[model samples]
Target: MTYLKSAYKNAGIHHKMILLIIVLMLVNFAVFAVILKYIFHIYDNQMYKKTSEVLNISSIGIENELRNIEKTTFKVTTDEQLQRYLLQLESETSPYTKMVLRKKITNRLIAFAGSETYVYSMVVIDKEGQVMSAGNREGIPQELHSTLSELADEYDGSNAWYAAGHSSLVAARQFKSFTDSNFTLNGLGTLAIRVRIDRIVADRVQTSGRDGQLTITDGKRMIYPETPLLSESDMQAELARKQPYGIATYSGGTFFAAQVKSSYTGWTYLHMTSFDDMFRHITIIKEIVSTIFVIMLLIALALGTRLSGSITKPIVQLIQNMRKIEKGDLDRLEEEALGPVPFSTQDEVGLLHRTYKKMIRRIRELINENVAKQLLLRETELKALQAQINPHFLYNTLESVNWLAKANKQDRISEMVEALAFLLRSAVSFEEQLIPLRKELDIVRSYVTIQKTRFDERLIFQLDVPEELMDAQIPKLTLQPLVENAIHYALEPQIEPCRISIVARVREGSLFLRVEDDGPGIAEGFLEKLHSGQVTTRGQGIGLANIQERLHLIFGAPWGMELHSESGTGTSIHVCIPYVKGDQGHVQGAVG
Candidate 1:
């Protein structure tokens, strides 16, 4: 009975709590609905309309280019030079005379077709299946004879037509001979021009406006300016459908995409504008709304707290206890009991108080369970580390000696051995402490020198270290791991010679060390995973992960690794550590 009363009193619910929650929820819902309808919906609709306009413009441009090619083919076929070539071939009978005629015709056709920018290739074939003239014989397909025969019948052996293929657009025209004085027409030969479709699409795609695509298709096959967004089968399936459809989806927090079919070509053109690019204003609005919501929430909490205190004393005490629990205190409730009340209450305040007690108990149990598990995990990790030191220590010692012997520098070798000894001593003696930037760079240089001997001519190293930043404090062995990572991941895979650059500079009292490589860059999606501290299937190479962990532990969130890369370019790892000069140590790089 005392427990029930105590729980009721400490629940911290009042009439004002009910009223405030109801009002805020209603306000939030109404605002969200109104904004969604007026702002987001209308904006998306406008985007769809704009996308359709762009598709229409692109369709018109493509149609115009196709028409231009057809017009050019018509003009070339009717030219006086082409007629003369055909007449010369028809009049000849001897093999030498025919060969001479064929050469003349070939030269004339080449001169006429080569003058145009878009004409990929031209070929002239006689009615007797003899090749008379040709420019770029590679363009002439094996199936040309059949195609020309059909074309010859359609246009009375003088008409022009376009053929669509996998990688080329063929424009063929048949020429005739006027031999007799009666002006009778005789089939002479065919002229065919092939144009690269990819190049043509590329040129048109470039001129298309934002989010616009130029699509070329003839009933079955389609060519899109953009690479296939949908699978080939999916595209074909979508194209097969007769009715026009449009849909908008939120992809990566931005709305982008509109598809339209060309009535003439039966090709669908899809225009995609990044929502992030288009509706920046919405993000701004969301930020403003979020800021306003936070401000209002704070104000509401303050008012609710003050108002509820007067009406409910026991409830206020319960809230204070809950705050203690929030601060990780799960001992016991400090407040006393209030009067008896049923668990089922019509009032909102009573319901809230009942729910609060149940939640507090559950949270306390979870914390206790989590703490025990964490302690066990930490113990297991410590045991694992203790078991794996001898092998690592021996390996590092051997590597130091090898580096010394290869360099042939006794003095530097002695210094490096001493440094390695000191590092080992520090590791065994002192747990871990921040060290000078000079010490870190020394370790990094030694590591690089060791790797350099292995790679020899294939690896080149450059360093740009400012004198002023040498003494800046940093986590021990901080720079070494990053440099090692640059070598292992960036340079090791390359067959060609690679360059590794290390730059250390001071920026506004903060020391920055950048390790860079001119090898195949880090794989795409690596940066996001590294930044988020997400465990990936491909392990973060050796020292890279260790360096990041140490930075985070010593300098919190801001002073850690920043990675940048592009495929085929290379990768860069930037380490930011706070600078401290003389006795005046600034606590600017405190860990979170």
Candidate 2:
């Protein structure tokens, strides 16, 4: 139970988990806001678009109705009986005949007016400013009479003439008489039809509450609804100019208004609908979305708090364990006590725990093994170093005796002893693995000095070394062995003086040392076998092989020794190494 609790505590909430929740919430909110805003805008625009379409349709219907009324009035004005009565009145001289014609004309006009619902009244006026036939004079304003008289003067006795108003529409036609082939005139008379504009408006306004209010206006006055509308001066100013169907607001409410201009008579029609009714559905949807968002937020908060704690506890415990490891408390690490701390998931943290446990086991094993190997290797190197001293001591003792005899003028015997001493010194002192180019030169000089004494001018030696490369390091006794081999093969059996040359110089940032002997050059197969590590000569010893190995180890295979020879020309052994002057210790112990 305690282990379980510790694991839970360690697995604390990840910051990424919290951040993920925040991002999700914000994204959801943003998406909801976008959808809501778009839906509301689409709904509002569609409502206005649909309203405009309806108003346009209504204007067309009203225009058609007015047109039908004009057709009916035109038929009545051109009737055969009315035309004949007017023609008879033109020739009537008797007062009794004149009265009869007048009565016929008046009756005809009265019958036509009563037959149509849209025609409020009809009237005939004579050329002498005398009214002949009239209907429903009660509804006709007195001020309109003079306006009618002016309209009559402009009429050229056509089939029909019409005028439109905010509340009504009117049509007028002039009457003329025809007698035989000549036209005879009694009086110029006018026939007029009056239309009820309110009835046409009533047909177009819908009764649905969501359809909003409808209003009609002329430039100067409100006609339909017949009440004051859009009382706000600012709103009124905006509506005063004619505009096609679009959204606008007034003192009472916001609305969409459409205007139609009549082609038959130059009158403007306005249709207005309130904005409040158009967007009512959108308000309901917004309220629903807001409520849902609140409820979802409450649910998310409740669930997130609990889940975050569950995830965070185990992570916290893991962090504490890591801190203990950092403090070097490896023994205190509760490996078994860590017990399978349930990450409870197959993700990266679980993999990390498994990997860490395996790494700890491997690390402990490596640490113990490394410690043991270090001690053993140190003891073995010490033994190898101790084994190098006995040969060097014996060679030094022999050299001391040779120098003593040379001081006593015992020259021939001293020379032989000196040669043996130098050979022994070169063969020993293997522990001093690297020596300077100058030191190698000194060893070679000592060997050559003894050789010259023994041979008595039969062997000639030349040494050419650059001053700059004198201190460059090489393997100890590297050049001495090569020089000995050259002397043995080239001069020991020669009849006259044999020329031996040693040259040391720096070439292309590497040291080049060459030993050339002017004697019958090596056997063709012998040089190949020497470089291939195949021993060829009966007693060649390991001199050349050892030098090649040391060169290979110090400077790698490419920078090692190369032998060039021709049977009669002589043999030259060349050694190449990177010039490193101050790296004596590294040169002495470096492995090929």
Clashes of 1: 0
Query: In model 2, which range of ten residues has the least summed lDDT?
Result: 159-168
Sequence-dependent TM-score of model 1: 0.43
- The whole-model lDDT of each prediction reads 0.64, 0.68
Candidate 1 CA-lDDT value: 0.64
Write model 2 residue lDDT over 1-592, tens digit each, in one string: 9996776566536544555566788799889899879886787677667667776677677668767776775576567777777666666677788788788888887888777776677766555444565477434544565566566546655534433444544666666554454366433466666667667767755532345545555445554444434653743575566656677766677766666665654455655556656566666777787888778876776577666655566556566767777788767455742446565667666676667766767776786788899998999899878866776677777778778888898887687777667666665656666678887887878778777787878889898987888888887777777777777878886777889989988867778899999988888787777777675322226567777887777677877888888988898999888776855457534322
**Best prediction by lDDT:** 2
Error of 2 at 117 (Å): 4.2
Question: Candidate 2 overall Cα lDDT vs. reference?
Answer: 0.68
Error of 1 at 234 (Å): 1.6
Q: Across residues 505-551, which tens digit of lDDT does each residue of candidate 1 receive?
A: 87776777888988788766866665565632222233456667777
Q: How well does candidate 2 match the true structure in TM-score terms? A: 0.58
